[model samples]
Target: MRLGQRLRTIADMVPIGVTMADIGTDHAYLPIYLVEQKIITSAIAGDIHQGPYLSAKNAVAAVQLTQHISVRLGNGLEVVKPGEAEVVVIAGMGGANIIDILNSRPEVTSKVKRLILQPMIAAALVRTWLHTQGWQIVDEQLVQEEGKLYQIIAAEPGGSPVVEPVLYEIGPLLWQSKHPLLKLHINELIGHLRGVILAMEGSADAVKLAKYREYTIRLKALEEKIRCL
Candidate 1:
């Protein structure tokens, strides 16, 4: 099972030595890769749906990693207890869904040393919610996979946080680190912004125009922020 470079990079970013859990483990690839590489001693491949759970179970079995990898069918961290895992990886989901999983259980949140999040979309919402909850993004990575750019953020609880308004749009680490691909992604977003503003033209409703006008302003401000970047 060859994981793509982007997903493989996310797997690489996992703490070199620790027990971790992969939530919504569709094919259980991350865990299998980590354990096979001996980076992690054990992992819990958990998912909310039966299809993914069974797929993960079958994969784990085929790899003969059943002992090192446990496949459980459960939602979020409801199946994980505190102090069991030091690292958690949640990927291929929306930011809001990840936030919901984090907010759903305090016990799981309190025990982890790191959270590796690779949201498919709504990353800004996830980053904002994490900042509001006092989590610090320690590091991040940017990669273009299958024509779409994705950001992978690793965060931990505690310490002073700095979340600028524009941080949500471009990500604090991406802005601070100035990851090269970030510029390209921002450029793409600016193009989208232009198209959105163009689409809003000829709308007669005052409320609709007002709402879009506000969004346009926000987009322009975001454009300026990127320009500065």
Candidate 2:
């Protein structure tokens, strides 16, 4: 039941003593581990793909947790019923897919008490969606697993009005708390933006030029903010 750093980070974000549904659950490792540790009472492991669904089913049976964990073969929140789980975890997928899942089943999602999301790409998009859709990014974690950085967001059903652009680009909690990895992540983003700006310098495309200037301006602001930090 050993969870990798990425999955472990997501697992750590789950509140204790609440039933959960793990969407896109490949092998049901997180649910199995949580149940074994007594961190959760029961879980639903849902996977869209047949191979992974069967794999998860076998994994759950191997551990003799058939009664505690329900392994279902369905896409996104379709497998999750309203009030079935207080928390829903969607991990190991792109941010767009996570957003789609949430949007596809707002009826079920609205009733969910918490959402733990780990977006492999386009994390900012996920944050933006959360903000605009009435969910709050309550907590966030940045983890570099096997040399690749991953962002995990934990959200609840409510939030106050927020500034979209800033919260979307930089996590609300991460920016305010100044997490230990914030500086590192900012530096990496700055470097990447700088490279993009440079590549766009020789281009005559108006769109590219506009984006280049925008990124350059943002780069300077982020640099200055980092200096203050």
Candidate 3:
């Protein structure tokens, strides 16, 4: 019950009895919590680094859940075999890193039923890759922790895309639902877009200009939407 707000938000997306692989699991709190709550019968607590893996091992041992959870030392999904995990939870890392992990093991995506991701940055890039890779975005949610907003997406291996490039930029599902945190998330995005636009404007380089212009078009639309807020 005392779980951190961020972990709790991530935990809400896990369905009962689904085997999970917690990539970049620092102390393996998510898998431990899920196993204790009976939401997951088995889980793999994976960390690319040995320090974190040892920490996860100690934590699982503390909970007497070493049997239910397997803490493995390896990078990304390297410790997980194909068809091993039904649900893959990748958290506590940037979206780019998460994308790299998935990209490295294309077969892992094909084998899993669900992917729950919480990206520190570049979520749009992750969403973009998911779109091209035939992954379907079924659910999207946001949470604010210590003045920072985090986006968590629940996606599968295949489906029609409900979001466009701009939506990916603004998290279409979050905008449509009008979640209470949308205003904050939108404003931050707008600021980022504006900064990018301004920096691009100062540069006379044509290539950067064109790239910035493209981003500006989306930013302007976002600016207008945030206006009503």
Candidate 4:
């Protein structure tokens, strides 16, 4: 099965011959591809909504992978039991929501060998959560699809904390490796911060002013990072 650039990047991070669980699996594409390629022995494709649950069921059936892949309708990691899967994949969601899912089931998440996360926004939160939880970022990938850029983070147990605040926003590994998309990502972030600053210009509200100053500081950091890049 052919996967999109974003999903393909996430899939590539999965280790060979492991049991995987994919949360919010839109159509079970990722699991199906991995199972078919023999990358994973089996998988649990889960989604909170019924439509996606049925869609995943049908997709797995169409490919005659019913025995290898189980489609379940549930929220977050609730679909799988502890020690059921070696790798857990959460993609195409906001950073906060992803963290909630992980936080929701510590038992399930704690047993997992690895986490492959793709946060749609506020990736810094996700990175911070991982660091605080002692999950070291093993690898990071940046991919652009349909004019939007996505960050894929792969983490495992026993990682060090990220000391620099800006490094959390710009992935430490991505910065160290100088990913081809790093400069573009930084530019995009700078653009977003600039837009926020411009929108809050002249606002006297204490909360707004405080936020404005925060954005200004972050914007300057990003600008400095870009210059070095």
TM-score per prediction, in order, is: 0.91, 0.91, 0.94, 0.97
Per-residue alpha-carbon lDDT of candidate 3 for residues 140-208, written as tens digits (9 for 90 to 100): 988888877899999987766556567787776787788888888988988887887777777679436
The number of clashing residue pairs in each candidate reads 0, 0, 0, 0
Cα lDDT tens digits for candidate 1, 1-229: 5788777878878888799999999989999999998999999999999999999999999999999998999999987889888999999899889999999988888889999999987788888887888888888899888898888988988764666666786788888888989889778767876777777775656437677877687688778877786
Ranking by lDDT: 4, 2, 3, 1
lDDT of candidate 4 over 138-199, digit per residue (tens): 99999999999999999999968546788899999999999999999999898888888887
Cα lDDT computed for each candidate against the true fold: 0.86, 0.87, 0.87, 0.93
TM-score for model 4? 0.97
Name the lDDT of candidate 3: 0.87
Q: Once model 1 is optimally superposed onto the true structure by TM-score, how far is the C-alpha of residue 149 displaced, in angstroms?
A: 1.1
Q: How close is each model in CA RMSD to the real structure? A: 2.0, 2.0, 1.7, 1.1
Task: Write the residue-wise lDDT of candidate 2 on 50-95 in tens digits.
Answer: 9999999999999999999999999899998988999999998998
With a 3 Å backbone cut-off (N, CA, C), the pairs that clash in candidate 1 are none
User: How well does candidate 4 score on lDDT at residue 175?
Assistant: 96
Q: After best superposition, candidate 2 residue 143: deviation in angstroms? A: 1.5
Distance from true location, Cα of 14 in model 4, Å? 0.3
Candidate 3 displacement at residue 137 in angstroms: 1.1
